[model samples]
Target chain A: MMLWSVVLIPAIAGIAAMLPPMRAVRRSLLVATAVAHCGLVGWVCFATPVVSRDSWFAIDAPARIILAITSVLFLAAALYCVGYLRREEGRTTCDAEEGFLFHNEPEGIFVGCLLLFLASMSFVCICQHFGLLWVAVEATTLASAPLISFHRHHRSLEATWKYLLICSVGIAMALLGIFFLASAGRGHAPGLTLSGLVSSAAAMDPVWLKAAFILLLVGYGTKMGLAPMHTWLPDAHSEAPSVVSALLSGALLNCAFLGLLRGHTVLAAAGLGSFSGELLVLLGVFSMVLAAVFMIRQTDYKRMLAYSSIEHMGILAVGAGLGGVAATGAMLHAMNHSAVKGMLFLAAGNLLAVYRSKNTCDVQGVLEKLPVTGCLWFAGFLAITGSPPFGLFVSELTILKGALDGSHWVVAALYLAALGTAFVAMARIFLPMAYRLPDGSPHDGASSPGAREPVWSVLPPLALALAALVLGVYVPAPLWDAMRQAASALGVL
Target chain B: MEVVSDILVVLLLLSNLYLLAASRITACIQTVALQAVVLGVIALTSAAGGLTLVVVSVTLATMAVKGLVLPWLLRRAIRGADVAREVEPFVGFTTSVLVGAGLLVISVVVAEPLCSSAPADVSAMMIPTSLFTILTGLFIVVTRRKALNQALGYLVLENGVYVFGSSLAIEEPFLVELGILLDVFVAVFVMGIIIFQINREFDHIDTDKLSVLKD
Candidate 1:
């Protein structure tokens, strides 16, 4: 019942959101549902994990971590949405490409889809059945597709088309992978339940299992924004509303990662840990290196942040692939990345709103313009780059230690190099935006120096950055235990 | 029953071929719809026992949505776009057909090991045929320029999944199967809506032109 409520509550609210004619009531509904969902997720994570009768839905350790991250990020995005929408209200924006004035997508549809997106993501975290999980993951894509094109501009429409088609096709591969999985366990294992697959893993056909694992990796990896399959991510992320981008990077990607991790767990249970682990490491390192190469001199800051998301996802994949303590590190990194990246995107939204352009060159002297957001953006940059005094630093250190312990010297070297390059690349962009004033710069926005930042937008990301800071210094005992359990569940330790 | 299933599988493979060769977008949609109807029939015959409630409902739903509803939607989209034939696909029809033949050989080779492990009742041709369909769908998606054709390719890919899934001996929960079907329906429905939007926004549904946001 607890697990079901966590998935269903937001779904009900999403449906209800479409009915109300007034924007304020709908906005309030979004926030209220987010808060309630967060509370339920917190209970499910901290209290004893709940498995539904017949075992279709369960909050396992990994699920707990993802659910917690998603719920918290949703709450923050919800708060930010209220202020963001208020500003966007009654404003007709001109399309950059076609030069036609257009109102944004209806607020009800936007808010409704936002809530449904949350419901689907939460459903991704809780579903124990691979088939149902696929359904839910696809639901996330369909629900969020509209949000990607909310501006109704040519660029955003193209982004939505690419996102819809690419992700739909990618996830279809996962459905085939699920079929392979069933074939592997045909007449031997009970069904597609996680626990069932694990217990009966030894009985499964190895050949079909191998095929299943590879296809599952490719399928979910695409959604997780791993390179080679990450073609649609930058366009989609950069094009969507920043708050939506935050959820996509922070929550939606993790849902896909959870799908991949579940597949990893099954392979490990079958004593095929090394097979999948090596493949994961290869993809992980490649994603990181690719993201690093792209992050350098990226003109669009939102796209830069999108590349950063791909890099962080790569780090998580690497840590999980390394196993033992590194897998724990991967779990921790997932949380840290969610908090930090979510904070960054929301902060980026502030910059976008103020500067009126995503181009880094177009916006200058953010510190002089909006002091609080500028500070948060800088802090977010440090945290995302895995610098000290932030949660990512601890998690990245833990992963590095894991790589070293496993004697994967090459992976360790490559990981460090990529991290370094990304940090430098992002620093070149973010520092100038925050601190430097370009020579003979035209004022981008009418706001004078030290403009008062909206409390709604500022507070949510501030809260997230503080959370990342707290985790950097100290991880609570329960969370540490959950991370360890999650690692072990994947046969890492 | 065996002959019937074999004929259905053959029809599916041929329709996949027709899809690749057909120049008209409407023709492609009709071919895919016919394949869906064929699959609906296959779903009925492929059930381990004689038809049950689950099998009947699945068959009816599959045919109704894939055969009747989806093609109608695609037709409406094409009408709105005011385009008919695929003027110049990235891969020419002759080349696509050749690739389709090559995919068939690959599918046969790839399905060998899985076929050996499959239960006696499972058709040897089913796995390979489904693989061919899946590859053909992907091929279409990759080689087609029109957004509508890509959408068709996606539908083909999904149909291939259904065929492969139905051939397996496992008993999936009814609700999950329904969810998969519903998801595909929504995916196509959503794609159609987007295609209309793309047509309106860009003045052409050619996806190649939709490349402004690239890095």
Candidate 2:
């Protein structure tokens, strides 16, 4: 029942938000839905996950961890949305502009689509049937398309198109992969449920199973922003509104990763774990290398963050590919990255709101102009780059240790090199923005008008950053256990 | 049923060539629709036994969505955008046709192993034909500049998968297949909306001009 509510509440609220109502009422509905959904997620997380009788959907250990992260991220973003939307309302007035069609859609659509995004993501996490999971992931893409285009700029529209087209094509391949898996299991298994497939995996046809795994990797990898297929990630992430970008990076990408993990689990059960793991490692390394090269001279800070997401996604892939303790590290890193990256994007939003540009060169003296956001931005940069005293650092260290333990010396070396390069590249852009004075002759450090951020916006990101910090210094035993259990659920143990 | 299957497969492959060689966007859309109709027919004939209600309904749904609904939507999008009918492909027509031919041969070679493993009920040419269609679809997406053409490519790609899926004899739930069709429909609809917005923004729907964001 709680499991059902976890998926249903946001869906119901999404529809309700679309109805003609007071703007305040709609925004309140978003907040209420987030809070209620978070509560249900919490309930489901603490209890033993109850699978439906058919096992088409269930809250497993790995899913519970992801669900908890998504709910918390959604809650934080939802709180920020109240302030963000209110600010946006004061800024834009018209519906259409000369060059752009529907340049300004109603705020109701954004609110409604965001809630639907949450519902679809929830479905992705809980769905155990391969077909249903594919449906849920694809639904997330559709639900978030409007959110990506909310700005109605040409660039955002282009981003939305690329996002929809590339992801649909990629996900279509995933559907093909599912069909292959079904074909593989035709004589062996009763259905395409994960449990059923896993139980009978050993008897499945190896050729079709291998084909399915390859196609599934490529398909879900495209969604997860793996290297060659990651062209859409930077564009969509950078073009979207910051909150939407945060959700895209912190929550949506993880859902796609979960889909890949599902395929990996089946491969593992079928005694083909090594093949899939090597492929993951190869893709992981490629993505990290690609991100490292791009981050070196990135001009747009938002794009930089987007590339950073690709980098972190690479780390998650490498860790999951390494298996055992590294898999646990990947799970921990996923949660930690969400909190930290979400905080960073929200902080970036504050900066964008004040500076009115995403270019690193255009914005300067953030520390003097918006001191709180500036500090958070710098801290977020540190956290994302895996600086010490942050959860990412801890998780990354665990992954490195696991790699060493597994004698994957080459992967460990490449991992360290990529991390070092990313850290330097990020610091070069971020440090100057936070501390340096604005370009051109400034009379003094006179704080610019509207430099102060609202407390509502500040608090959510601050809380998230602090959570990342605390998780670094000390992970609660239960969360640690959950990570372990989730890892084991992937056949990592 | 066997003769029907063979005729439909031949028609589907010919449509793939037509889609490749055709220069006009409307012609391409028509070719895709014709292919979808052929796929619908193939879906009916390729069932292991006489068509059950499940197979009948699935076939109808496929025809409605792939054959009628999607083509109609694409036509509406094209008319609304008021774009040129010429495809303006990145690759020349002759080259693409040759490439499509090459893909057909490759798919046949690739399907050889699978053909040996397939049950007796599965058609000999179904997997190769589907693979060839998928490759052709991907080829169109890569070589075409128009957003609408890319969408047409996506639909073609989906038709290939539908062919492969329908050829399977597993007693899968009808709703799942229906859900897949519905998803493809919605995807194309959303793409149509985005294409309209693209036209409004840029005064054209050529994706080559969408170069604002590059690393």
Candidate 3:
């Protein structure tokens, strides 16, 4: 019943949000539902997740970790939405006359779709059946489409189209993979359930299993924004509203990676771990190299952030591939990345609201323009680049140690090189935006009319950044335990 | 029943060729619809032992969605966009058809390994036919300019997966299969809405024009 409520509450609230109502009331629904959902998720994560007899939607350690991260991120984004929407309402009148990017659709659709997106993502986290997991993951793609095109412009439309088409096609391949897995398990009982597959892993046909894993990696890897298939990531992330972008980066990407982790679990159980791990490492390194190349000269701040997301995903993949402590680090990194990236995207949103531009050149002296967001943005950059006194630094170090302990010398070397290049690239873009003096008139509408930073917008990102900071210094025992269990669940132990 | 399934497989292969060679958007949509109907026929005749309620329902659902509903949606998208009949292929029609033939040959060669494992009555052509359909759909998606055609390609790709899925004798639950159909329907539905918006925003649904964001 707890599991059912966690998945169904947002869905019900979303439908209600869509009905005729005041925008304020609907937005309130988003906040209230998010708070309730967060509370429920906390309960489920701390308490032993009540497993159904059939194991269709039970909360495991990994699911708990992902759910906690998603719920926390959503709570912060939901709070930010109230202020973001109010500002948008203020801008729509001016936008109509000025012919700018702020074409306000009914806020109801945006709010509703966001809730549905949460629900689908939650479904992905908790679902125990592989078939249902696939459905939920695909549903996430559908639910987020309207959110991507919330502005309803040519560029957003194109972004939404590419996101929809590319992701749908990729997920279709995943379905093929699922079918292949089913075919491999032809003689097994409890078919397509995660536990069943794990238990019967050794009995499955190797040929089909290999095919299935490759296809699944390509399919979900597209969603995880691995390079070569990551064309839509920059466009969609850059074009979406900042809050939605935060969720996409912090929450949605992890859900896709969770799908890949599921594939890895079965392969590990079957003693075929090396095959999938090697592939993950190759793809991981390639994604990092590509992200490093693109991040070097990127002018759009949001696109640069998107590239950083790709690079971090590469790190997570590499950690998982290296196994042992690296897998544990990968789990910890997943949490840290979500916290830091979520903060950065929200900060980026604030920057966009202030500057009315995504390009780094158009906006300058963020420190002078908005003090809190600037500091948080700087901290976020440090955190994401794995600087000290941040959780990411600890996690990244652990992964590096794991790689060395395993004697993956070349992979470890490339990993460090890519990290260095990415750091330099991000610093090049970020420093100028943070410190350079403003060239344009200080009183432009680009800056908020009063030059006062709203608390609603500033606090959530600050909270997230602080969370990452705290995690860096001391990971709570429960979180460490959860990470261990999650690592072991992937057969690393 | 085996003979009928084989003939349906042949027809499905031919439709892939027609879809590759076809220039008009409406004709392409119709050919995909025809393939969907053939897929339904194959589903009906190829149930492992005999027609169970689950198999019947799956057949009906596939026919309704892939055959009737999706094509209608694509056609509606076409009318809403006021798109030209020309598909505006990136590769020449003759070249694509020749490529399609080559893909068919490759699929057969690739599927040779699986023949031993597959059930005896399952046509030797089933795996190759499905693989060819999937590749052709991908080709259409890659080569075509219009968003609707890309969607049609997606449908073709899905049809191929469905054909492959049914070739296996595993008795998957009806609900799971139904869920798959619903997912495909919704995907096409969402694509249709995005295409309409693209038409409204850009005044043309040519995906080639969607090159604003790049490295």
Highest TM-score, which number?
1
For candidate 3, give the lDDT of residue A481: 85
Over the stretch A1-493, how does candidate 1's per-residue lDDT look in tens digits?
Answer: 8878998999989988887665569989999999999999887788876554349888888998999999999999999999999988875886543558877988899999999999999999989999999999999999999999889888899999999999999999999999899888877777899888888888898888889999999899999999989999999999999999999999999999999999999999898989999999999999999999999969999999999999999999999999999999999999999999999999999988877788999777888788899899899989999998999999999999999998999999999999999999999999999988767655664445566699999999999999999999999997899899989879758
Q: Rank the candidates by DockQ, best first.
A: 1, 3, 2
Model 3 lDDT per residue over A456-475, tens place: 99999999999999999999
Over 4 Å off, model 1: A20-24, A50-54, A95-100, A441-448
RMSD of each: 1.9, 2.2, 2.4
Q: Of 2 and 3, which scores higher on DockQ?
A: 3
Which CAPRI tier for candidate 1? high
Deviation from native of the Cα of residue A405 in model 3, angstroms:
0.8
Per-residue accuracy of model 2 over B53-88 as CA lDDT, tens digit each: 878988898898888888898888867555657899
| Per-prediction TM-score | 0.97, 0.97, 0.96
Output the lDDT of residue A428, model 1.
Answer: 97
lDDT of each candidate versus the true structure = 0.90, 0.88, 0.88
lDDT of 2 at B104: 99
lDDT of 3 at B111: 81
Candidate 3 lDDT over B88-146, as tens digits, reads 98899999999999999999998888666777777888888998998998898898898
